[model samples]
Target: MHQPGTVSSSLHEHVQIGDTLLISAPAGMFTLDTTRTNPVAFIAGGIGLTPLLSMLQTVVKQQPERSAQLVYAVRDHHFHAFAEELQQLAAQNPAISHTIFYENGTEEDIEQKHCDYVGRITEAWLQQHIPADAEVYVCGPRPFMQAMISILLRKGITMENIHYEVFGPALAFSVD
Candidate 1:
């Protein structure tokens, strides 16, 4: 059965990014918790912003009494997805804070007055952006997610508070 507000086509919709179009958004297990009031942190990279958008919208609608920090990583500003929407959300929600990191930019550029963070989301970066006891969610490419998980483990972050979602095919190990 097709659910209201959701497309019920076997074919995926093409989400355009600049001049590029890619299939996306069929169905997913993750959903927003409109009732959560804890300090929350989100780490996103590339096109991983889709699911985060849903959660952010839900939070805005529900108006949960919680502080949120979103750390988004991208190659550069041009390829950064949903930049304007994120900016708008941050402006609208007083409880939300944002930090953007461009891996292609130098440290000085990122540390400049208007910029957020520079380089990739390293252990030090995570430590600086996320609170020690905050509820953390990570969504990105497999390598990025793995790196974040490693950093969290090193920082002694509990598994219960850390969540992650991956897009695309699951990596498999094969013996030669």
Candidate 2:
């Protein structure tokens, strides 16, 4: 997890090879419509990458005709997980596109092509990069998801076409 909390951190610190951890089946409302052939765009922030990445992989493997776009934001390289796997997927699949944003990117990171953009994601950047007609799935911190949803709505994307999962308490937004 990118932003580990008390439970996750404790598990990481204390779990052993033979640890019998109780896990439940995955559940969430933010689901991908694999049956649709529309282009898929994923907007992820920090630890939110996990679910979105799974969807991306499924799309790549099961629906080769569908195009996928990933816009990932993280604190920096250290927090950027699945870097190699992402690169490999994009490299092997011409229909897949990956863009990464680093909040604390160094000059070397950009010069060496480690990140696509520096600084936090913005509404303008999202509008310019992500296709408005694409089916969008977003997962991120509460505030990030809120802002992304608001922006997508304002960009003329119907609420039904945008799906998101927030990490914290549920937040309500005023849809125009």
Candidate 3:
């Protein structure tokens, strides 16, 4: 996505509102099981926060008691995407919460106050925040997701408890 000549790059920089676009029917290998009431953790990085937003909204309306948490990683407070909508969703749904991790972030500030984090998320951080038994869904840049998957494995979370979506031709998963 950082590559300038790629499709993602062009879309991110050049797409305009009201512009007609063609798309295919929705498809993905992973989806949230709405009937499940177990604790859940969603880990996303940068623009990777896209997919989980809709799922969280559904939880807010239909399963207010389903415990859920979103941990998003970004370059900094100013660059964090979806902060407002996610925060609003969390506020409206008692069972939903969100945390933001800023890799090149400042000390606790107005931006950090809302999302509850201002630094890189480490294994220790995950241990303290994410429940050991919760189902975790991760979507992010390839390397970040890979690192978090490794951490989840090291923490004894089984493969069945982890869910990730493959984006395009790459093996995609979530974590920042």
Candidate 4:
């Protein structure tokens, strides 16, 4: 989380190398279905890149023939997570197409080859780049996810084809 809470802060500050923290088993419907071979587009905002990155890496290793596009949006070049891992995965897999968006990036970010784009991902850009038939997976803050869902809907993407997950309380599916 951007601002760690008490528990998270304690873990970060004092957890030892051999710490055995007990946790509940992972449970979520937001998992990727590796059975389908359709093209996939992953849209992430800030730290939301975590889950999508796992799925992207899986596709690269298991479904080598599958086409995958990762559109990652962060506050700036500094906030971009998994840069090296992403680059290595993309370099090894020709089917993986990755684009990083730096909302607060500058010419230096682009000049330094830190980001491919320097703004939020928009409807126009998605339409021009992502295939309509591609299965889309989105993970981000509530507002970012809402905007992405709205844009995907407006772009004629069915709800069944668009998948997303957000932290904290559940979000109502209403989109304006």
Off by over 4 Å in 2: 1-4, 10-28, 168-176
True-vs-predicted CA distance for residue 175, candidate 2, Å: 4.0
Put down candidate 4 lDDT per residue, 57-114, tens digits, no spaces.
8899889999999999999967889999999999998999999999999888999989
Q: After superposition, how far is residue 34 of candidate 1 from its true place, in Å?
A: 3.2
RMSD of each: 8.3, 3.5, 4.1, 3.2
Per-residue lDDT for 2-67 in model 3, tens only? Answer: 563278678878899988888754435568888788898898977778887777777778778989
Pick by lDDT: which candidate is best? 4
Error of 2 at 46 (Å): 0.5
TM-score of each: 0.72, 0.84, 0.80, 0.86
lDDT of 1 by residue, 58-104 (tens): 66667645788888888876677887888888888898878888888
Lowest lDDT 10-mer window, candidate 1? Answer: 167-176
Higher lDDT: candidate 1 or 3?
A: 3
TM-score of 3: 0.80
- Model 3 bad stretches (over 4 Å): 1-6, 11-28, 108-115, 170-176
Global lDDT scores for all candidate models? 0.71, 0.86, 0.78, 0.87
> For candidate 4, what is the lDDT?
0.87
